[model samples]
Target: MTLNAETMARFAQVYRDNRGAVYAYLYGRAPEHDLAEDLTSETFVRALRAFDAYVAGDRPIRAWLFTIARNLVTDEMKSARRRRQTPLPDMLDESRFVVAEPDPAELVSAGHARDSIRSSLARLGGDQARCLVLRFFEERSIGETSTVMRRSPGAIKALQHRGIDSLRALITTGAIAP
Candidate 1:
């Protein structure tokens, strides 16, 4: 379906409203800031391209948007070839807000911690890493994580437990410092 003026307006509003959360979600999984930004751009491009197929009542708009974002990250991790990232539709630039940047020293400390956690998560294997990121970094509820991951809430709970255990082991072994 062609995005009529109304759909175009709605899509633009969504891009403006949801970009930051999408960026943060990608940021936790991406290896670098630039890749997260690139993935954020690509998520909306794919969302709009596939918009015709989206049925509004199937899920919350944020959920749909995140589903797109999650798939892109997974694809990026799996693919050898890098796809070109797309720019946002024209009007999105106008409404973007500037936030003060974090301190460089704190940023370095946080980046090290994040890398350590990610490394531990990688060692844990399976969906445990994704589960922890969704639970903690993304600030998603157990039910929301279950929906996003297509797992049962019980399964998510189990993954969370296992992921935490793995992280604790890493800390104990001096794999990651407190």
Candidate 2:
């Protein structure tokens, strides 16, 4: 499908508005920054290629973008699993796999509260977690979140409520300190 000037402009606007949220979502799910960056880039590239097929009124653009990102991550995981094989002794390099310690300054930069919140978020169920991320972290309105999540607004509200309740319980239990 050919993308006209108007469609290209709209696609650009959508990318600009949702890029950070997409990257954050990818980072949250992926184990490393470089992997997340690669996935995020692939997400946008696929989105651009499929732009002609997207129906604007069916769902919010942000939701469509996220669906693409989610699919890409799933594909990457599958590909990794398929490529996995037993390592031979000669190919092993213990010295090359050093784990880096977290920087003290970076830890200080991310306040305790933010860390706690992230911990709690990680424990939430998939739907609830997505709702919370879209509604709170990304600052999307309920209507917008519902569109992206492909849920009714009422369902989104319920998920948000349950997610918040779970977060509170976690914090109260010191699983995630306030």
Candidate 3:
């Protein structure tokens, strides 16, 4: 599909406006920062390439960007599965979590607890991670998260419960203090 000048402008605007949020979203999904950067770039490229096909009311562009990013992550997961090996965790030491670059004011206000929370959230299995992020971080409704995560509502709820439980465990262990 061809993105005419105006559509291209709109797509670019959307990309610029929401890029950071999308990057942070992908950062939580990807195994490494470099992979997250690549995936974020691919997401924008795909969104630009598919701009003309994007209907006005199907969903917000932010949500649509996530849909694209999710597809890229899914494809990565499939390839990883075919290779058949246990992937390494990004955070081997809890100390690495504390050494993050100086955070923004909002993150500071949210407190170190949020970073701890995100770290725990990141530890969830893929579907649980997807469900938790979409429902809580992205503020998507249960139905919307189910649609994006491609699971039944019951499954999402179950994952959400387990994910929160594991996060609580992380908190209790002092791996991440609230």
> Who wins the TM-score comparison?
2
| Ranking according to TM-score, highest score first | 2, 1, 3
Pairs that collide, model 3:
none
| Candidate no. 2 TM-score | 0.63
Q: Score every model by TM-score.
A: 0.60, 0.63, 0.54
How well is each residue in 19-133 modelled by candidate 2, as lDDT tens digits? Answer: 8888988876676678999998999999999888888896668778889999998988888888965756776676889878899888766656666778778876588778988
Question: Where does candidate 1 stray beyond 4 Å?
Answer: 56-67, 70-107, 148-162, 172-178
Regions of candidate 3 where Cα sits further than 4 Å from its true position? 84-119, 122-169, 174-178
TM-score of candidate 3 relative to the true fold: 0.54
Candidate 1 worst ten-residue window by lDDT: 169-178
Best by lDDT: 1
Which pairs in model 1 have colliding backbones? none
Residue-level lDDT of model 1, residues 35-71, one tens digit each, is 9999999999999988777898868887888888899
Native-referenced Cα lDDT, model 3: 0.76
| Winner by TM-score between candidate 3 and candidate 1 | 1
Backbone collision count in every prediction? 0, 0, 0
Candidate 1 shows a clash count of: 0
